[model samples]
Target: MTNKVLNALANNSALLKWIVFLLAAFGFVWSMQLFIAGNAYYSVKNSIEVWQLSPDKASTQKVNSALDKIDNALNYFPNNALFYQIQGQLFEWKAITEANTKNTDSPTTDLTNKVFNLQEAAKSYEKSLKLRPNWSGSWIGLASVKRQQGELDDEFYSYLESANRAGPQDAILHKFIVDFGLQVFSARSFHYVKIKERLKHHLNLGIENPLSRDFVLKTIQKHNANEAVCRWLRDASYPVKKRIPNCITYN
Candidate 1:
């Protein structure tokens, strides 16, 4: 009798069909999520490519369009940490745009808009970190936002440290830390350990990408820290070193 019951259950076509239907539904949901995410990422990628080609063309309309798409993606998949990080970046840039075009007649209104956007950026970064605590970019994003707000507390430095720990050799991470590193070089609360090492790493990448050589040297000079920058690049390859003759000549 037990064998008969087993055979009957094994031959249950209705149960098998329900199982197949459930599997297909799960696959469809998963695929649809990826589709939405891909479109959102494409929107971000396209915006960045355009900005790189024509940064002077940055405008409110372009940013708002990107923000709208990302918001729609978040509505469908609220758990994507990367989406939150991207959202944070968009808000941060929007705030920068507001800052660059402050209205003299309505200075208070401009400041308020800038602060509100920055606060929103910070919240998005915090949400991303909560979802995926170890993402180096999100850490950098939060750190950048805090710096913008001029509220660089212990956590701000900690976030930089976290980003450093997460991706020590990442060229992109090196770029961010070097920029922020120069800003707070003399701050009493600044974390000094490994700071120079990261800057050197960035300069090394600048060496490989010679197009960035001038930017690096210019940034270094602007900070009045070319002396230090020259010292860092003293050991880099010879070809790229020649591009920054001012630094490498005496370096």
Candidate 2:
């Protein structure tokens, strides 16, 4: 009876050990699955936040850093359209910085560099558009670069027109169009146009027309009157009607 009791006790101990081992195995598997799921959620959440934050901020450094993080995430999920779009936007931000820093004394060289950067930006935006054709912002970005480059005026206009058609309700798109029109006027008058024509075309009477008025107003607001261009701009602003042409009136 003592030997039998001892044998039964040994059997119970072995069964308990097997149960404990199985439980431990299950726990390990469950823990691993939870960890993996948590990591995936964190990664996706971070990516979405970065996408949302990039376009809202105007700082170049911040935009670039966000894009770098997004690119790193893409190694794991290579097909994220948002990542591509944000990357394109970052490139565009850089291009805008380059374009706006032009030097009048070295207009040719400065413009050349600006054009190169803008073209690169256009390529990146085109890539984003390829991934997500419905993104109106990408089309606007592409058009802005084309405008900066000055090599494809018609194509640039077409892109802007398409962007408008795609989403006329987007106030940001309209603002971009307005700002771009102003920039083009500033650059053209500052570098390309003769003083007389610049005044007549950009600042003189009937200039308040929709197309030219915004540009004239923006130029006067941003530049000083000491320069010849500024002198004309100042003179142009005197008569309100003279500064803006009737045809260019915004409804």
Candidate 3:
């Protein structure tokens, strides 16, 4: 009886030891997984912080260095569309800096450089559009470059229309289209009444309202107009005959 009791006690001790060993193994595995997950989370967070800081760096040298780091990160994550879009925007800023230096008054002398920089901007914007086709700002930039080149008016208008369709809430596009109409009207040669009539037709103005009145006022202000037209437009109550009669009559 004493031998049987001792055997039973020994068996219980071994069984408890095995249970403890299994529990310890499970705890070790859980701790390791937690450590690995925490490290990965921190690493991804740091990488995103670096990318966010790249564009905000003040100095051009610092910005370029940060951008290089971002570029490497982007390469590692090629599927990230936002990174490509940001790269394209940086290229646009560089191109604008280059183009603004070209003097428009000497178009013949600066034509090559001007066109080259503008084309670079257009390319960057095109790439951005490819990454984000629904982005209206890219289309607007494309249209602006075409307008600057004085070519592709139809195409430019089409792009502008598309931009409007994509982002109808954006009032700036409507303003741009209106300004373009004003520029075209300003370039034409017509008497005040005829000019006003043409603007009303083209701009869809029903009468001599505030916008149409302002358009005529701006036209007189821009051109070397006779004093008569200027005075009348400036103060509509002024008698027309009190000043010079026509644009051709001005010195």
RMSD of each: 5.1, 13.1, 15.3
How do all the candidates rank in terms of lDDT, highest first? 1, 2, 3
Error of 1 at 157 (Å): 2.3
Give the per-residue lDDT digits (tens) of candidate 1, residues 1-251. 69999889878977899999999999999899889877987888568545533555667677888899899888888988889988998888888767778789998999899989998998998899899988887888888888788876888778888987876655446556666666656453345454656667777775465444445555566577766666777887777566554665443
Residue 220 error for model 3, in Å? 12
Model 1: per-residue Cα lDDT at residue 175: 56
Q: Report the alpha-carbon TM-score of model 2 versus the true structure.
A: 0.45
After superposing candidate 3 on the true structure, give the runs of residues whose Cα lies further than 4 Å from its correct spot. Answer: 1-109, 189-251
Error of 2 at 41 (Å): 16
- What alpha-carbon RMSD in Å does predicted model 3 have with respect to the real structure? 15.3
Q: Number of the top candidate by lDDT?
A: 1
Relative to the true structure, candidate 3 reaches a TM of 0.40
Clash number for each model: 0, 9, 0
lDDT of 2 by residue, 18-98 (tens): 999999998997687556544643554454344333333344554456556656655544555555555565566655544
Off by over 4 Å in 2: 1-63, 98-117, 184-251
What would the TM-scores of all predictions be?
A: 0.74, 0.45, 0.40
